[model samples]
Each structure stands twice: as C-alpha cells, then as structure tokens.
Target: MTFEHAKCPLCLDQIAERSRLPDRGYQYQCPACGGPFEVSALAQRRAGKVGIHPGARAKMQQHLLDGKRPRVVFVNTTPNSYYEVREVNASEQTIIN
Candidate 1:
C-alpha cells in the first residue's frame, strides 16, 4: 500500500494518508490542532485553513458531490472567479482553474 503525506499549515504537523479520506479528493484532519484540510490531486494543490466545524465540512462535502471545487478563502479577500470542476488524474497536468 502507498500513502500520501502533507504538512498541516495550521498546526505545522505532518498528516499521514491514514488520517485522510480515501476518496478522490483527500480530506483530512490535523491530529495536533484538529484543523481540517484538503488535498486535490486534480488541482495539484493543498487547501489549508479550512474550518473544522461540522457545518463547514458538510458544506464542502456537498460541493464536492455537486462537482464543485472547494477552495479555502481567507479574510479580506474573495476568489477572483469560479471555474467548472473536472476530474483529472495524476498523469494529466492541465488545469482550467
């Protein structure tokens, strides 16, 4: 078996694949600070500072089910634009958003 690892930007802890959901997008919780984060293999980016609140996580999951990409939004700023979400494998690197 193989595992993917990422650093929790909030708690600065190393999160192992065991802590993540085994679905298409890797959703994980930081063991140290209990922060929620996601790594999108399609986007090839990690979204940090996502809320650990139940409602937030639910909303994110809903978006994923609806074929939307969930992005971490910071204070005092908003996403410039929205793009259609599409699934891409590791072998493909073209991203529209």
Candidate 2:
C-alpha cells in the first residue's frame, strides 16, 4: 500500500499509474480491461484473489459506456468479502473504499 504503484486487482493487468484517493485506496486505468477502477490497498495486494465478481466487472463496463466510472468498493475481509459497485459522476470526486 505504501508503494507508489500497483496493478489492476481484478485482471492482473499493469496499471501504468495510480492516484491516491481520499479513502486511501488507489485508482487507475487497466490497459487490458479498458477501464478505470478503484481498490483498497489490501485488495490490490490480494490481486485477483480478492474475488471481484464477474457481474461487477460487467457493471463496470456498463458504467464506462455511460460515460461514468464504476465506483468499486472492494471489501475483502474474511467472512464478508464482496464488491459494491456504484456510478460516479465525472465532475464529482470519487470516494473510493
């Protein structure tokens, strides 16, 4: 998490760069997946093993097509690992979790 860079957590694709968010997570675009996503530092470390559902990925794509960023909150704690996908307005700040 202290690292300045990271890869896409869902696809293992390289994230050329990442920006820190208010929640302490990072956001970056995945070249392979062709979209932007946010993940907590812990989820980033877990990589694809963090368990982002296929449906969430689908929603992300939809958000892109709608000119929005999928606000993905990856809660990867034991006993309740899950994804909470939301729509983000471009003009609004992304509150990543």
Note each model's CA RMSD in angstroms: 10.0, 4.8
Worst 10 residues of 2 by lDDT: 1-10
Candidate 2 per-residue lDDT over residues 11-83, each given as its tens digit: 6556645677766467776666656666566555545554567777677667766767766666767888776
Expressed as tens digits, the lDDT of each residue in 1-97 for candidate 1 is 2345666433345563323334444544445533333445432232333323344445555555565545332223265422222333334322321
Error of 1 at 46 (Å): 15
Estimate every model's Cα lDDT from 0 to 1: 0.40, 0.62
Model 1: lDDT of residue 11: 39
Q: Clash totals for all models, in order?
A: 0, 0
Best by lDDT: 2
- TM-scores of the candidates are 0.30, 0.59
